[model samples]
Target: MGVTIRPQVGALPVRFDEDGILQVLLITSRRSRKWIIPKGNPMKRLAPHHAAAREAFEEAGAIGEIEGRSRGHYRHRKRKARRQFRCRVAVYVMTVERRVERFPERGERAVRWFTVDDARGAIRNRRLRELIARVAADLASSGRPAAGQPA
Candidate 1:
């Protein structure tokens, strides 16, 4: 039997409010109707954090800075026409620097912000939800103002 494989990668884009309520950005897939974070294939010779940043911009029209160390890793399944493949994704924490309502290339997605709890429930992947929870806890304990909030 012919075997199929899916490569794994990493991504982390966080949403923060002025009140320090940590949130995450999720995009709705037009066809799948699944709410998922921004992520893509690894860049050539680029680290996972860098790739994550790039994916955030491409997928969510986001500009952000990665924070702290890598959060951790998670595994996911990719379904194809007739088979499924497993992938492992590394998670990192990021601070949103800017967001543009109109992105140049990503027209297939609808971007929205979700509070930690809502984000956790929106994502179908269990591992990714766990990562979001961990990052939200870290941000809550960091004592920083949420993004776009007046200090």
Candidate 2:
């Protein structure tokens, strides 16, 4: 049988420092060790945005208020022991409000903050790269972050 395609949720976590410089967070995948945003398949009884937030927390020690609506989506491969599945991820914009020193999966992943230019380079997915570009342009024009408002 072909690998079943399923929808997942992701959080594009961002934080603005005192200087108003916007930065996006990226974390290394547990298995592939690739740089990507926090994401996972949806959990039962949780809203999509909530699931995205949970993934962010568990994967990167991120705590934030996520927009109820998704900004966009991207597809990636979910690698298993000997197979892979394509997952369509609905992504939400999370304005980072807190950072914990230790979280549920702290030791399993490496997290970093990067500028839009760096993010474009870090993320390989074309759709995700375009999403970052749109977010950057929206933020640059409005002087506000992309908080899931059609960015």
Candidate 3:
């Protein structure tokens, strides 16, 4: 088995479309270009959700309100340089207010908004995809906006 790496934080940036349907924002990984949620290493001085929000801004240009509670966590192996390691990432939900044209990592990533089903299809991580599906179902059934905020 590969070495266990430090746990990371991630954000599921979401918003309601003009028609009030929920949409998710996904970004391409810097190297692989695979669709994924915005994520990064946790900052020791920042709370987990805050770190997740920061990653969203840097990776996806997403500015939003992040829920304090995590949606869930998933484990995956990551390849950095010439080594592979396992990492556990806790994901928070962010209700995105807007996206900026530029961010810290804007040049290195591709960002896009997708419908719940389309987002699920685009994501390669099975655990993350399932987590998003559950969250979308809950938000849809409750008739509430992302992060349980008022519509």
Candidate 4:
């Protein structure tokens, strides 16, 4: 039998500084404590992008307007106890309006912001890094703020 690949959703939370420079948010994974985007399994009754938004809020305390269209897809292995399952993640771009001081998983994970270049270096997944680069380039050159970005 072919291995089953799980479907997951993710959000790449981004915000602009006073200088109009873009920054992306990264959260530490609960198990590995490595820098990663906020992500989770698909939720019932919610669209994929909405579920991605929920993951961002719970994992990174980020509240934002997320794009419904996915930026890209990536595959990674999810580890649970002694088992590992391949997971395919569809990532959406979220333009952060603000972040709260408390959230569901606030203390369970560490959250931080990084510049586009820095974010690529911090993320270990090659496909994820490429996605970030592509999104960053598009946003930077677009010459207009996305939904929640500062004008």
| lDDT minimum window of 10 residues, candidate 2 | 142-151
Instruction: After the best TM-score superposition of candidate 1, give how far the Cα of residue 67 lies from its true spot, in angstroms.
Output: 3.9
After superposing candidate 2 on the true structure, give the runs of residues whose Cα lies further than 4 Å from its correct spot. 1-3, 146-151
Give the TM-scores of the predictions, in the order they appear.
0.81, 0.90, 0.93, 0.94
**Residue range 1-151, candidate 1, lDDT tens digits:** 7654455455466755777566778887556869987766778887777787777787788887764346777776776688778766666566777898777547888888888798888889888888778767766787652333321
Off by over 4 Å in 4: 148-151
Tens digit of lDDT per residue, candidate 3, span 91-143? 88899989999899978988999999999999888999999998898778877
Candidate rank order under lDDT: 4, 3, 2, 1
Model 4 lDDT per residue over 82-104, tens place: 99999999999998989999899
lDDT per model vs. reference: 0.71, 0.86, 0.88, 0.90
TM-score, candidate number 1: 0.81
Best by TM-score: 4
Model 1, residue 91: C-alpha shift (Å): 1.2
Model 1 worst lDDT window (10 residues): 142-151
Best by lDDT: 4
Give the local distance difference test score of model 4: 0.90
